[model samples]
Target: MNPLVITVNVKSTVYCDFQLRWYPWDDPHCFLNLKVTNVPSFGLLVDGTSTVTMRPELLEEYEVVECRLQETPHPTNNLTLLVHLTRRYQYHLWTTFLPTSLLAAIGYGTLLLPLEAFAERGSMSLTTLLMFIALYTETNSSLPSTAYLKHIDVWFVFSLIFLTLVINVHLMTFLADSESAGQSVRPTPSRHLTHVSAPPFAKRVRDRMAVPKRILRMSTVLFALVFIIFTLVYFLAIV
Candidate 1:
């Protein structure tokens, strides 16, 4: 019979497995067994970094063993060799997480801009979103496909959602400002000039925006708090 061979895939860069097995034909009085005397690093690039553990032995059923014994006129049994491994993806923090965090910061900066600078804020938000999309696409392309999401996946998804909400805030603020500006446009009424005459146009506009501006500021704070809480919970859960 041919020797047993096992191959593993390291595409995930998260974990790997190795299996080794052999069969022995002997009398019932004699036994065949395997043991782990020493485990080398397996020639991995990141040797000693990955966590490795073995599974309990799994023996073949009695029926199968008996059949093999009778058919071959010898004693034989089957066994399994299994191992589990885990690895941390520290590299992604710089390559993926850092850039994503910066993108999120850029999105938040747009909120501080004045509502009158609609074009500037809108462009900033859109640009941040586009750059985030490109970064996400590039990162995912190199990862192996899996049914379940990875830790980095969660990070990217949350970042995208945050950016989308920022963009929405910009849109809503612009609309509110535009509506207020339109309503404020009225013919000046002739009246005796006084020290307390109607405030300058800029001050009047600013006064009208007090509520919306407060609401926008509160929304920014709320977004930040939510993001911080989410990140804490997510990291704790993952760890």
Candidate 2:
């Protein structure tokens, strides 16, 4: 008789089960037993996964469990391998995630630059955005095609979103600063000739010019908070 063969594919870094079953031709008169050869002569496992003698990039290790059942019309013995595989996140956390995170933090650094120096700030924002895109592509290339999202995917997506917000915030501040700078300056009446207090309307205009600065500060704080929260949530959930 030919040997039975089975194949399966895994999508996520989660626990999975693989079953090997055997049934006898005669249930009561004859029975079948099963035994698993951990270290097969043909080399059954490759780097803790059932691969063709070559280590894979993302998977780690597995576990095996066995059981038997007699309630069925045809009694059978089953050997269930409970495979516990984890995404190899150490390298990604260092190379992909760390660089992306640092770029995001540095992206906010542009906010510290002089608002009037639009060229410098705009250049920094554009560079950071490109870095994020490159890192995201590198990370994706390492991963296999899967229908569902993985833990690592969550981190990259959130990081990209944060960077996008930073760029938009800088853009808002830039426009506000430009308009304020171009406004016609109202000359103060000769203080030497007459002691005159500043008009209420003039004070209101000055106060409004400060709004953009306040928005920049608030946005910085918000970005920092969100980045920290995302980092914590992602690591905690995956680990």
Candidate 3:
């Protein structure tokens, strides 16, 4: 009997260039182009490198052998790679993405509050706004402070400030309208009958009717002016 010669591929190595592309709102997707090389123990006829491209659609098929951020260090310019390895991506999702979503939900909660709950509106609005600011600050602490605003940070601040202003406006409008309504319906004291005798029904009717209509008109104008002025001032500061 002749001894059998068994041939086996001992080592397989893969080199891939990954490109991560995503919209501003959505989680990023990665595409990989791999050059798969097969090494054999003994010299064989079939030995070559094959190029394989893997996209997000095909990620489920292959087990990610090794995924890491390839950092190229330079003395002059330190370039940080924002690569997301599959295992480590969850950290960003939880810390950055989920929290931002939660904050926006909290802001929307203010709208559901009853208009009569003036104190609750004021407190909730301010509290949520401050919480947004604190969260944004904490998130940015890990990054460098630069002049240009980041997209997430800008979105957070805009939503927060808008909610805050809206709550404040609602409070002010409720108060002003309440006061105007009260004045419009106020009963006037009669000059005669100092001891407070109920006048005849006709007299009462006449007195009520005599209340100047101009006062109601004036109140409407005043309320509109106040609201306009307040809005102008508030937005001027924000912008």
Candidate 4:
């Protein structure tokens, strides 16, 4: 009797479970299983001779970093091909990361303004905040909502927090300056020490003004350090 040999070709769609905790920075893995069906288990066989070929245009959004075929283990009667997919981040980097970074820079820039330019600084922070809101909305709209926060979501929250704090700082300093100026003009009356009180009142006004200036300087330095640390940890460790 002569032995019979035959070759079969199969292709079909399969389901993949994706982890999106680090989305936009996430690399997901998938497996393709080719199984023999409709025959007794003893009549079917699989071997390393199986091959996986992908069309050039099959994947446009991801790069296949690794592809390996593994013979099915004893428990499972199938051939498994493991495909490691790395997300292409250029599109997201340009649309989201770059824009948020620019907004953060411009928001922080308001702090670099002259301490006396409260109006200009406040206006800039508000404008930057509005721009950031629009960007965050557009970004989130493109992605499906998830239960947990994504890596990029953390970044946006941090930026929004920083901008909100900047605006509050400006408001606090504005109120403090206005109150101090008002007090400087309307000093308390003292019959015995009227002339002698001028220097002390002037000193008091300087101290009050100094407080806001110091707050601005401290906030600028502190926020800058915080942003640097977040970037380093996010890229070097978390990512």
Candidate 5:
């Protein structure tokens, strides 16, 4: 009797469950398992295996870092293919990180404006708040919802809160000025005829702004420090 030679070809689809806490920066190590059946170990002993995968579509999301093939010790023959992948972070960094950061800075910049710049401050903070919400919605939609907050979620939530706080500060300042104006400007009796000179307009303006100026300066410092500490914690904990 003559010995027989057989050639087999197989194409397969694999499902990888990735851990998404790190999201765009996640580098996941996954595995594929193949179970050999029917043939005994002696009958399947002589051939080597090779992979010829072209990963263009995969490369769009991740870079293939390494792959290893090994046999598991099992009653049924088991082969495990280990694959290590690093996510492509540029897209998220540009679309998500940079824009959100710039928006946050713009929101904080409103605090630096003149203490009575109600309109400009309100407009800028409101616009940035809306934009931040839209970005967070878009980003969240692209990802599967998880029970725990992701690193990106932390940034989005806190940034939204900061913008909201800025708007509240603006609103309070506006209301305070409105109330002050209502009770103010009572006519002084014949100051025009008195010899006592009135303070210059610039000096009055400076005097009126003193308390608000100090409050705004403190706000700017506190807000700036909050942002800096959050940024540092984020990078240290996540990066």
Candidate 6:
């Protein structure tokens, strides 16, 4: 019977002399068993074509291992291959994922504010959204200029736009409610009601129309329209 022997090799910048053997009968699925004696780094580069140095003694220990042919070349060579395993990839994790998630949380702040406070609280949403935009810009500045959008950038921009629209819509709703109430009652009647005893229903109506509804409604509508048009133009410009 011919003795089953397998050769193993290590290819690296730092000396990584290793040997591998296959034990086909031990594990049916994975017959290859890799072992190294003198190498410092256990990580091996498995690029398709290379003469890898192997210690003969380690191969002799495991006699029945099956060796599989190389499928594809390693995507990158030398130290470039090692970069994939390093902590550098963590930048992608923190920059893109963390800020986008934080922005989404900040967006919920708008919902917490009373709808009546939309006039004053509207700035909070816009400010938070702008803060995210600034963060997105800063994060992007650090990244390499690539044609395709990064995952985090996409999420941040989407959240920014979404929150902007949400704030605008709330403002518009408040303005419309205010304006309708204002138009329903005349200013002359409102002035006279202050002197005479106003009906309970009239008092409620006056309270509701305390805000300058007509001007605000027109302003809100115009703001939304301009914002929408600008957003569309900006998106087109970016694309």
| lDDT tens readout by residue for model 1, 1-239 | 99965655332232332121110111122122222223332321222232334322333311112211112222223212222222334556678878999999999888888766879989999999999999999988986565666666778889999999999988787777767777677546658655545569888788768766876798789988988898798667644
Q: Write the residue-wise lDDT of candidate 4 on 198-231 in tens digits.
A: 5686687677698688888898899899889988
Highest TM-score model number: 4
| Residue 236 error, candidate 3, Å | 31
Candidate 2 lands at a TM-score of 0.59
Q: What tens digits encode model 5's per-residue C-alpha lDDT throughout 1-239? A: 99985666668988888888887678899888876675775433212454524443367788888776654333335567778999888888899989999999999999989877778988999999998988888888987688887777888888888889878877766665555444344456884676756678677666655555666677789889999999899878865
Evaluated at residue 171, the lDDT of candidate 5 is: 74
Q: Per-residue lDDT for 1-239 in model 2, tens only?
A: 99977654534343233221110010111123222344344433223222332233332422112222223232223322322233333565577667877897789788777655668888898889898898788768866545655556666778778778877887888778666646525565565887666558767566656867887888878777887887787666533
The global C-alpha lDDT for each of the candidates, from Candidate 1 onward, is 0.63, 0.59, 0.49, 0.80, 0.76, 0.51
lDDT for predicted candidate 5 compared with the true structure: 0.76
Candidate 5, residue 92: CA error in Å? Answer: 0.4
lDDT of 3 at 121: 59
lDDT of 1: 0.63
Model 2, residue pairs in steric clash: none
For all predicted structures, in order, the TM-scores are 0.61, 0.59, 0.41, 0.83, 0.77, 0.45
lDDT of 4: 0.80
- Residue pairs with clashing backbones, model 1: none
How many residue pairs clash in all the candidates, one count each? Answer: 0, 0, 0, 0, 0, 3
TM-score of 3: 0.41
Query: Order the candidates by lDDT, highest first — what do you get?
Result: 4, 5, 1, 2, 6, 3
Choose 1 or 5, whichever is better by lDDT.
5
- lDDT by residue for model 6 (154-217), tens: 5456667667765766667677666667665655445344566445886766566555344345
Over 4 Å off, model 6: 1-89, 187-199, 202-239
On a 0 to 100 scale, what is the lDDT of residue 42 in model 3?
Answer: 32
